[model samples]
Target: MIWTFVNNTFEPEEKATLQTGDLALQRGYAVFDYFRTVDHVPLFLEDYLDRFFHSAQTLFITIPHTRSQVRAIIAELIKKNNLPESGIRMIATGGYSPDSYTPVQGNLILQQQPLQLPDMARFERGIRIMTYAYQRDLPAVKSINYLMGIWLQKQLTEKGLDDVLYVQNDLISEFPRANIFIITNGGTLVTPAHNVLAGITRKKILEFAGALLPVETRDISVAELKNAAEVFMTSTTKRILPVTEIDGIRIGSGTAGPLTRQLQEQFIRLQESVTTAPYSRA
Candidate 1:
């Protein structure tokens, strides 16, 4: 059984429906955020909530529920579903609008589904990344505009690529969904400082890695990235994924590097230490 939180209560998935003329449907005008549950606990709840509110403000929309209320609702959904571990997607959309684009009343939906991640072998063998050049509009906000990613489907399949990292000018921006982190030849951890979503997973990786090595949060150029000793990507779903190749060129012997493995191990350790309290009133 699956449960969805819409309006103010939990309902069966089939019963939780949106109208055909809703802005999210009519105009694709909405903002959303996603995070996962581990051992029945919402991971990085504060950070995800912060980004959610920031995205809402970026769209000039207001969520009707308070932070505490949202937390309670999440806790209730977790308990009700009894899924233990799942992906939670929260969306605050521009509600029913007669004008079609303006925010009338923000429609909020919380959805839970089984968590999906790359297999353990992918982490060991690493994966591949291909490059494209297009920057996201309102780069700071996580909006529902994925026209480019959707448009890249043909190119991705024809090239036999796993994912695409977007670049602009000569500088690399980020992947369509994840943050890029490259290990320089001089032994520094570098990621883009601007024009990308500040992901919670990326933030936590930087914090944990800073204690052990040199970390630089700045604009990374495509030329510099090509020469890096190692490259990796981070997101709520993949956690830390090593990139062994980009644009058909090999990265770091075309295999997952030591530093990337070390950080992935450390991230798992940190996640294990996270508890179920404080983020919820339950």
Candidate 2:
């Protein structure tokens, strides 16, 4: 991927650079954010960048560029690459240090990669998910450390589950890569309030369903989830997908419910409404 920075600069040697010190070998102090676009228009870019800066602040990692500068760089990167539809990932490493415990400097890397469409069959028939005992380390910040998800993927697949849902105590937290929501029997939308990443698509769905549905953001028990009329998950890449079965139990007639399908249609319309024309550098 091409690397660019402030002052309208491009780095030719960034691809070959590697960290050799303690931070590279031992410490795993890093954070990142990934967002994608469709038909050339960035999907919720402002929100993604805002979250990226917030994650940086929470992790105490200094970004290589200022927020505005980074935004400009992103726009330029998209233009230079002529990316019509792609995924953009930005990473910040704690940098090389004499000791693993402390960082000497920080390195920032941004990449724009081709977007890979997910299997549409999974959405139509819904996916099966297995529950995990562990929860995310930093629920709020999007970090590069994803060991738990990595470790559980194979086990989940082997168990005939498409994904893993993290269960802490009796509460159903979230899926490995998506935020979850359940439609209760009382028609309330229940989901984990705290200790979960606030997904961009999740936020938008809540906004669109405002006042139309009684949205309750709180801890939902696994038992409560089992009795849910409809269960769904949201993410940038996955959009809104129904969870038809969880650990062999069918969820809400074992098919995509009416509410889930309604929201999915709304989401598609919202995506199509965004401007996809190439953005000029600001």
Top-scoring candidate (TM-score) = 1
Each candidate's number of clashing pairs is 0, 0
Sliding window of 10 residues with minimal summed lDDT for model 1: 273-282
**lDDT (10s digit) by residue, model 1, range 1-282:** 799999798989999998887899989899999998987888889999999999999898778798888888999999999887789999998999998878888889999998977777898777777889899999999999999988997888888788898999988988888999999998899999999999999999888899868999999888899899999999999999999888888898787888888898899888877854564423
Q: After superposing candidate 2, which stretches have Cα over 4 Å from the reference?
A: 1-16, 22-25, 276-282
Alpha carbon deviation, residue 54, candidate 2 (Å): 0.9
* TM-score between model 1 and native: 0.96
Candidate 1 residue 2 Cα shift, in angstroms, is 0.2
Which regions in candidate 1 have their CA more than 4 angstroms from the true location? Answer: 276-282
Collision pairs in model 2: none
Residue 225 Cα positional deviation in candidate 1, in Å, after optimal superposition: 0.9
Candidate 2, residues 23-54, lDDT tens digits: the string is: 53467787778888676567888889989989
